[model samples]
Target chain A: MRATTIHAPRDIRLSTVPDPTITAPTDAIVRVLAACICGSDLWPYRGENPIDEGVTIGHEAVGVVEEVGAEVTSFRAGDFVIVPFDHCDNTCPHCLAGVQSACDHLGFTTSGQAELTRVNQAEGSLVKTEGTIDDALLPSLLALSDVMATGWHAAVAAGVRQGGTAVVVGDGAVGLCGVIAAHELGAERIIAMSRHADRQALAREFGATEVVAERDDAGVAAVLELTGGVGADAVLECVGTDQAIRTAFEVARPGSTVGFVGVPHGVELPVRHMFRRNIGLAGGMAPVRRYLPDLLDRVLDGRIDPGRVFDLTLPLDEVAEGYRAMDERRAIKVLLRP
Target chain B: MRATTIHAPRDIRLSTVPDPTITAPTDAIVRVLAACICGSDLWPYRGENPIDEGVTIGHEAVGVVEEVGAEVTSFRAGDFVIVPFDHCDNTCPHCLAGVQSACDHLGFTTSGQAELTRVNQAEGSLVKTEGTIDDALLPSLLALSDVMATGWHAAVAAGVRQGGTAVVVGDGAVGLCGVIAAHELGAERIIAMSRHADRQALAREFGATEVVAERDDAGVAAVLELTGGVGADAVLECVGTDQAIRTAFEVARPGSTVGFVGVPHGVELPVRHMFRRNIGLAGGMAPVRRYLPDLLDRVLDGRIDPGRVFDLTLPLDEVAEGYRAMDERRAIKVLLRP
Candidate 1:
């Protein structure tokens, strides 16, 4: 089997590895149909995160079950499914409370960008589609595995309400999906902050009522202006940079919350400022498994088209090019066909 | 008129000051019946918060309306009212959203410990008690002006629900009031963190089901063990120090929010840990005016007794001793009578 592996900074390659097999009673062997690179993956690829040489990469995918252990009762061979990035036993106390990201038996699904991947907690982590799905919907269905669900989590965490205004702080795939989530959640006005013309246009298509192309202080000013000088009702922080996090809080109203999903990097939370303004900070590593059912339904019903975030696509063999394109900002998100 | 003024740290004096008169169209002058020393007030008395010499200090009081400006429609002379610590125009956007503390025209009520106090935004900040009967209820009504309301804000912000478990950090008047708040909100179990024997007893009487006298790491371990190692469903942070804030988060379970109402000092938020654990932080200065109606009703109906926190009572001229008693931890809270 061939899979994506990371060796060092900017050193991504499609290498030949032994085929994965079900090693646990609750595990399942899956044949991946589609997978995508996340903005978080750029951390190690850009040397921002320390790397363990020759580690399996990629954690988002849609696949078909090929084999399942005796204990896996929810899925069977040939079943089409979306694999949540963080696998968990759904019966745990945290999972039951809708915080599957903090599940007691939590595990990450690595090597997902491969021909064959072994998934633990199969019965709990995999959400299956009703029947044979159309090939054109693969990208959207695959999005439910992580990005789309993460965006939904940000909106929920921010308490985006009907007729309220929401500000999305990044223009990446997850941020774009956040625009959709806010819209679906009945946000009357969705503001997307993006400096790129292409990303801004996509943001508009994804239901952003306005686009702010400014950065830092100017960006905060633009959002405040759009919200009648009161700041937004809810803010979705999709980028974890210090500047992005700072801007997100600055543009939130007195009692609004900032829901952050991006893996924080050198981010120092403004505790005093948050305290004085009565602003709150919520959201974290998204509990994608918890949002899978509702988001999958939205995708199947065509209520949201998150697949448009895939501006570039590549064959699994061109995995290095995919990583390069994303790292260099040439693609919003790159979809890979196995 | 005589008022409590700060000459310097530990230098409290009841000195003659000009009588308060209606200055704004929305202002009202009130004759103080009762005022209490707050934990936050001790910050300035203990030389922690920088002091402005000769400034009037207290901000919590229940009084009889002595006079009202021409435009004051909701209050009149001889009416008994609870003056919230912060005064605001009720029609402001933030106030309309139930966040009066962040009102566009927000103002603080000073000189509250004096014989007479001028309260701005009379129509908005004064909640008049209907035909007040007994002086015995004065302390409870005064508590509603700040500490009790602040504690209620913490419980509301932390999303306390029926059948949930709540943990309160701090054992001062505000934290003791928080135990009452959690119980009123239907929390099945309330844990109080305190080291002082007197305060622990008061907390238990106020509705704390369990008391943990441990501090720092030991406190976190005890709270974790209490909730089957999952932590509390909601945590109320009534103390503003870094250690108190840290302990509040440490005892909160995943997806639970830590509601903080203390005036934060030297506090650094655990952003990475919060992000990884999916814990949230919310609440700030209490919008007591917004809660005045319900809390006032509760007090009048004998459903709550928040005034029990005031264990020491003194004549208005003894304000200096009242400050010393609280500063020396001799009293949980001090009630000053005019």
Candidate 2:
């Protein structure tokens, strides 16, 4: 099997890797149908995060089951499914509480950007579709593995409600999807802060009522103006930079919430301001396992097409070009067929 | 009129000040029956917070309305009432959303440790009791003004649930009151971190299932052990110190919330640990105005006696002793009668 491996900072290569096989009673081997580069992938790719030589590069994908262990009861070979990034036992205390990301026996299948990957806790981590999905719908189904579920978690964690105003701080793929999630969750007004035309266009198409090209104070001012000076009822911080985190605080109303799904990179909360304003901050790695089922249903029903985030697509062998395009800001997100 | 004023660090003096009078259409003048010293007051008395010379020193009180402005429709002269520390207009958007502390026109009332004090937004700030309370109930009723309401808000914000375990950080009046609040909110087990015998006894009486006489790591370990290795379901942080804040985070389980009612003073959040653990932090100044009605009902019905936090009693003329006792740790809280 061929896979994308991160050897070091700004260093990625397509190379041959051993095919995956069932390693546990609850494990299932999946033949990857589609995989894509994630913003979080950029973290280790940029050397901002530590990475070992030849480490597997991606975690989001749609795949077909090739083999299943004896204990796998809910799925078998030939099933098309969406695999959540985090693998958890559905019966664990944390998973039962709807926080699958913190499941006691959680595992991950990092070789997602390859021809085959092994999924642990198969019954809990993979959600099977009713029937085989067409090739055209692959990108959108693949999104359900991470980005879409993440956007949904961001909106839900921020307590976005009907008639509420939602402000998204990043223009990345997840941020654009957050606009869609907020709209689906009934946010009356969606504000996307983006200067890129392509991402902004998708944001508007996904139901962003307004787009502020400015960053920092001007951006917050624009949002406040749109909200009658009350600021947004909920703000999603999709970029983990310090500036984005601070902007998230500045653009939120006194008692509003800031749901931050971005992996933090040198971000520090201004405790005094947060306390004084009574703003609530609730976010972390998305428990995609908890939302994958509903999101998959929406995608299958034609209610939403989150795949619009993929501005570029290519075959798995061209994964290097996909990473380069995203890193150079030429593409919002790139979809890859294996 | 005579009032208690802070002349400098550790120096509280009784002196004559101008009598308060209704100054706004929504204002009311009250003759104070009782006022108490809160742990927060120690910040200025101990020089941790700067104080202007001769500034009045108390903000919690019960009194009889001396006069009401023309626009004050719900309150009138001769009515007995509890005045929340902060004044708010109940009709504002924030107030309507149950966040009275962030009300659009929020303002603080003068310390009612004087002969007369002015209450702003009188219609919303003053909660009139059914009748004048007897002498024995005065201290408890006065508590409804701040400490008791704050405790209730802390527990409520932390999402205390039936049969849940709750950990309270801080042994001050508010922390003790939080134990009472958690019990009333149906927390099956309440662990109070306190070393003072008197406060510990009060905690036990308020339904604390256990008391740990340690701080930080030791305290968190004790709480976890008490909960059988699972951290408390909710944690109420009533102490604004950095150590107390950290302890609250260390003692809460994943997906549980820490309700912090303490006025933060140089406290910083551990963002990385918080995110990875999926813990939620939500709290600010207690919206006393929002909880007064319900808490007052509880006090009136004898469901809880929050006034027990006051371990020392003194006349208004002995205001210096009240401050000295609290500052020297001789009393958890001090009550003063005019």
Candidate 3:
């Protein structure tokens, strides 16, 4: 099987790797259909986060089940499915609580950027599509595997309500997707903080009512001014930096919630700052599996087109090119067809 | 009028100050009937938090209204009221959203430990008792001004469910009261973390199903073991240190919440650790004014006895002694009578 491999910093290669097999009773062999390069994947690609040498890279994928273990009762061969990044048992207490990201049998299946992949805990990690064979819809369905679900999680956790307002703190793909989620949540107004013209235009198309070109203090002041000094009712913090989180906290109205889904790095949150204003903070890794069914329904019903986040698409053998495009900000997100 | 004044670290003096008069159109002057020392107060009392020399130091109090400003429509002389630590305009947007503590008119009425205290935003900060005060109920009513309300906030914010398990971290007055709040929230099992014999007993009496006389890692381990490794459904973090916050995060079940109400001084929360399990963190200064009515009703109906927190009593002139007993841990809390 041809898969993308990372051997060192700024080192990515397309190499032939051994085909994956069902090694566990709960595992399933899947032929990769579509995969994606994530903002998080860039952390290692930039050499900021250390990556193990020769590890198959990528966690987001849409695949066709080739074989299912005896223990896998919910899926079977030839089924087109959305494969969530994190595989889980789906029967653990945490999974029962709808937090499969914290599943006791949690497994990070990062071989998705390949022609074939083996998924453990298949019953929990894979969700079947209604009916397939729509190549144009593959990118959108693949997004439901991770990024789209993550954006939806941020909007839902922020308590975005009908006719309410929401402020998104990042202008990345997730932030753009969050704008769409906010619209789906029935938010009357959506504010996107963006400095790039292209991203800002995409944000507006995704339902952002306004865009602020400023950063840091100026960004917060702009949100406050837009909110009439009371602040937005819901804040989606898609950037995990200290400044972004602080801006989210500062822009959310008293009694409002800030739902953050960014890969939090070097962030220091003081409870005192949040407590003084009755702010509620809720978010973490998105339980993409939990949101699969609803988001899939939306996709099937033509209610949303989340695939637009993938501005570029490349064949599996060119996975290196996709990563390069994303790492250089040349693409909002890249879809890889395997 | 005599008030408790902090001239320096460990230097508390009962000194004469100008009588508080109606300072704002919405202000009301209340003659102190009951006032208590708080754990947060001890920060300034011990100089951990710098205190402006000669500043009035208490935030919790219950008293009889002596006068109301021309614009004060809800309070008048002879009406006994619960003067919450923070005063706010009831008409502010934040206050209207049930977060009076975050009101634009927020005023920390710190003269509560004095003979006469002037309260601004009288309509929102003062809640009238059902009838004439019961001398024995003074301590409990006074608690509604801060500690009890704070505990209630923790329990409510944590979303404790009926028959769910709750863990109370920190054995201070607020923590003990949190046990009572868990009971009111219908939590079937309440675990109280405490090392003191008296505090543990008080915790059980207040509704704790069990007591863990442990601290730090041991305390968290006991809680996890008691919950069958799933961790508690709701955790109330009454301690504000880094260890306590970390323990609270570690002790909360995946998808569960930790409601913290302590005055955080040197705590830095790592969002990554919390994100891994979808742990929800919500808490801050108690919205005492928003809770005044319900807590007061509970107190008057004999549904709770929170005043037992104050085991020591002293005249206002001996406010210095009251501080000494609390600083030495001789008393769980202290009540000063002016």
Q: Score the docking of each candidate (DockQ).
A: 0.79, 0.66, 0.83
> Order of all candidates by lDDT, from best down to worst?
1, 3, 2
Q: Residue B21 deviation, candidate 1, in Å?
A: 3.7
Model 2's C-alpha root-mean-square deviation from the true structure amounts to 2.0
Task: Report residue A49 deviation for candidate 3 (angstroms).
Answer: 0.5
Regions of candidate 2 where Cα sits further than 4 Å from its true position: none
Question: Candidate 3, residues B89-125: lDDT per residue as tens digits?
Answer: 8788888888887989988777988998889888877
Model 3 ranges with Cα > 4 A deviation: none
Worst 10 residues of 3 chain B by lDDT: B123-132
Q: Write the per-residue lDDT of candidate 2 for residues B95-180, one digit (tens) a residue.
A: 88788888787878666777788898889878998765888888899898899998888898888999999999988999999999
Q: What is the C-alpha lDDT of each candidate?
A: 0.93, 0.88, 0.88
Ranked candidates, highest TM-score first: 3, 1, 2
What is the per-residue lDDT of model 1 for residues A1-338, given as tens digits with 9 covering 90 to 100? 99999999999989999998988998998899999899999999999999999988999999999999999998999999999999888999999999999999888889888888888889888999988999999999988888999999899999999999999999999999999999999999999999989999999999999999999999999898888888899999999999999999999998889999999999998988888789999999899889998888888888998999999999999989999999889999999998
TM-score of each: 0.97, 0.96, 0.98
Chain A vs. true chain A, TM-score per model, equals 0.99, 0.98, 0.97
lDDT of 3 by residue, A1-338 (tens): 89989988778898999999888889998899888888988888888888899998988888899999989988999999888888888889989989888999988767988988888889988889766559988888988888898899899889899999999999888888899899999999999999989899999998999999998889889989998999999999998888889999999998888998998877887567798887988878888889899998898889999999998989988888898898888999999887
Candidate 1: what lDDT?
Answer: 0.93
Query: How many backbone clashes can be found in candidate 1?
Result: 0
Which whole-number lDDT from 0 to 100 does residue B215 have in model 1? 97
Model 3 chain A: which ten-residue window has the lowest total lDDT?
Answer: A124-133
